[model samples]
Target: MLLSRLTGVSVLGLALLLGACSSTPEKEKVAEQPAAELYKESQIRMEDGNYRSAIAHLEALLSRYPFGPHADQAQLDLISAYYASADNPAALASIDRFIRLNPTHKDIDYALYMRGLVNEDEDRNYFQELFRIDRSDRDPHNIREAFGDYERLLREYPGSKYAPDAALRMTALKNRLARYEVQVAEYYYARDAFVASLGRGKYVLEYMPDTPEVERALELMALCYEELGMEKAQQDTLRVLKLNYPDNEMVLTVGS
Candidate 1:
């Protein structure tokens, strides 16, 4: 009787081990899934907002079948998945890779647009959002890169469906850049660095004309000129400011 009981326990343990081996973890099973199936699974995960899982599946599909029917779509979806997961670096890398490898891909314009968005969001500060802090004075390197990306999209893909939206974003980016210059001018002026302040103010007027910040730039230049004791230059700046913004407080107080 004892021998028979031991034999039954051993057989049960063997079956349990086999079951564990056959039931591979879902993530591990990704490697064995067919390319089309993997892509479909990724799409499902993406729809469900499971970006991390989608990323894994898309990446697997791309690796296993680089030249498969779904390769192109997988790459594009991977970029989106990375972005949705807040993985900016990975998103950028994937975008650059797509642009380089498939320059003539019908979806190239979409890749460019995604690249611009990733760069634009790269510098987004949670603190700024939470506190409503103005970030116009912050370093705008990423912002400039994003602006250039959109500019290239407009220049190269003029008729792309993304052109209209890109144009709008470009306008906003230009204004932000203009505001950055204005902030720098204000910083210099506060430190009594009138010459530097004047130079930055001129930059906005010359290169960033038509922006909403132009008036502020003009007022700042007028103040810089006044501080530097350049009466004629100050008068000229005030004349322009008054002509454009007659009701401006600076025009009222200083021009008067």
Candidate 2:
């Protein structure tokens, strides 16, 4: 009878031990569901092209499970949605936050790429805005700012998929910038403002060399020299202009 009682206690203890082990894993499994469900819902919303709804679902998931497995992916999706929806400022803000939060995330490369993407889009918009301006009210300062942003993206994200796009943008931006300098120089030249025109025109060569404007720059410099009574300087400038742009009508006009 005593042996039977001891056998019963051993069996009962074994059952209890198994139940405890099983319960812990079951609790963990339960804890994991909300995040999984959230991610699933976000994916569904994304597939439907309801980016805002996807973002909301992901945000809710993150709010409830900050350390969930979906956190990194959730961050990326949220920022991408903002970008797709034309919420650049918000996209940039979210990207910045994510970078600060997960500097070492495995998909850091993707984050970097997205950052470049947003900046490229920003540069496109800035130039569009700058170009759309009335010539009567075009601001040199705004053009300069747009150029600066383009340079920043090119410099910072050289390996981005958007690099080619940024390069194309830079080409257009530089041309506009070069043209702006030429226009300013011409304005000064028209008023017999040789000194100011020479300064502004010379600025273009420094900013963008070997362009169509280079001939104009040299021609203007020659004019500045003539106005200043620097005959040797005038002749020397004209010689270089002729050497480089022998076929330009202005060269003939100036020489004649």
Which regions of candidate 1 fall more than 4 Å away from where they truly are? 1-29
The true-versus-predicted C-alpha distance at residue 10 of model 2, in Å, is 84
Clashes of 2: 0
The global Cα lDDT (0 to 1) of model 1 is 0.86
- Residue pairs with clashing backbones, model 2: none
**lDDT (C-alpha, whole model) for all candidates:** 0.86, 0.69
The lowest-lDDT stretch of 10 consecutive residues in candidate 2 is: 1-10
Residue clash pairs of candidate 1: none
TM-score of 1: 0.86
Worst 10 residues of 1 by lDDT: 1-10
lDDT of 1 by residue, 193-253 (tens): 9999999999998988989999999999998888888999999999999998899999898
TM-scores for candidates 1 onward, in order: 0.86, 0.61
> What tens digits encode model 2's per-residue C-alpha lDDT throughout 1-256?
0101112335567677558657423111113348889899888978887776777787788878889888889988988777775566887788878988987776555565566556545544332343465342244454455455456656765775656765675676676667777888888998998899989877877878845677788878888889989998888878888888898676688765
lDDT of 1 at 97: 97
